[model samples]
Target: MTDRTLYIVVCGAPLASRVGDGVRQARDRGWSPYVIPTDAALPWLEDQDLGGAPVITGNRKLGESRRTPKADAVVVAPLTFNSLNAWANGNATTYPLTTLCAALGSRTPTVAVPFAKHDLAAHPAWLASLAVLRYAGVAVVDPHDGSAVSLEPITSGTGDAVTQAFEWDWALDRL
Candidate 1:
């Protein structure tokens, strides 16, 4: 594999169930991929096979050394409404959030694919948070098609279909 390290920050969403696809895709591209899932995402990953990519959860103890290597790039796929808002506001209340904040602060190349229901996306806070992330130079992509130029909300009942069609190349290609 190449010397590049790709950190895939997964959130709680239907799309998260397909994280194994991303891990395999990253490895095939010659990059070492790591999964950093939000606590809520744990259940989704239970049935996934992430190849050999390590899943990093919880924060390290004060004296503990870092577990994963420094990231060459980061992909936050299926970024939920809650996590997206928290990350945009710089709230590192959780391990996944902390990782996202650090990646943004360090200027690490990052691509985020937001997966929110249409109703949630209609909230004023949704667009505001997205704007905040865009201002921070994070590439915001549409999980439906990996379009960086626009982000559309997922229809309430279409999550499963959308997730099935999602490809890791969407986020990876952006990086």
Candidate 2:
């Protein structure tokens, strides 16, 4: 196995059911994956096994001891707009996902594949936060176009389109 371990953080999104697919994809590509879930995304991981990757969640206290040591990268799949805003505004410690995002900071190569509705993506604060994060060196990617996918309105995404838009390869490329 490669020395690269990907910490895949899952947030609450409709496509969260496919998180296992993300883990499998990462592993197949030679990076071991540790699936960490936000509280809202916990159900999607219910009764599922992610090879040997820890599903750390439950208020972020689930697997501190078992974390993939020095994960070469962090990929937040299905990153919700709320987490984006919070992470941008120094609200990191408030929730599990944001806490990890904040703690990892710019030290770790982090990629965020956002999944949000059109309206949330259009908010000024959302736009500003994304820009700020990018400036701070976080790779905030859009799942749909393989582009930065900043705070602008996503033109073609909904349902399966949204699911299909998740760019697994692009995420790894950023790291």
Candidate 3:
């Protein structure tokens, strides 16, 4: 356990299946990571090895205390288009979204890895949302190469390959 807390926010995308990689990398870097997954991400996490990190899902009970410590940094991997748009629009409808919104509002150091295919990435909102997040100081890394300079959309039918090729160090390095 370490004093630094890293919030790993996962979404429902092929890359989500590798969240364990991120958790392990975070811990190796001296960050006590907490996985916060969107409901849709549950399936992908079914067989993941989180290395004993806690996964926080859904809303907390009224009388329950906060489950995790304050985040020192946040990494949103496999940032699906839906969650990305919702987060950029400040929609805190779900637990994951609420956590993202709060992290953004608090100006927490954040890194987001968007995993949208070419067609979806072509939408006007896609680039706009990236712009919005960048303007807010979030490090937007390209899932393919961890390039913070440019983010290329994943080609159709290449999601699996892209996901497999992604490295957690790409996002963690930025932090």
Q: Which regions of candidate 1 are displaced past 4 Å? A: none
- Model 3: weakest 10-residue lDDT segment is 1-10
What's the distance in Å from true for residue 149, model 1? 1.2
Give a tens-digit lDDT track for model 1, residues 1-175. Answer: 4799999999999999999999998988988999999988999999889997899999999999999999999999889999999999999999899999999999999999999998999999999999999999999989888888989999989999999999889888989
Candidates in order, TM-scores: namely 0.97, 0.82, 0.98
- The full ranking of all candidates by TM-score, starting with the best, is 3, 1, 2
Q: Which sections of candidate 2 miss by over 4 Å? A: 47-49, 59-67, 103-106, 149-157
Residue 157 C-alpha lDDT in model 1:
92
Give each model's clash number.
0, 0, 0
**Per-residue error at 103 for model 2, in Å?**
4.9
Candidate-wise lDDT, in order: 0.93, 0.72, 0.94
Q: What tens digits encode model 2's per-residue C-alpha lDDT throughout 76-123?
A: 877788888887777765445554565457477788877778788778
Decoy 3 TM-score against native? 0.98
Best by lDDT: 3
| Candidate 3 Cα misplacement greater than 4 A, ranges | none
lDDT of 3 by residue, 65-149 (tens): 9999999999999899999999999999998999999999999999999999988999999999999999999999999999999
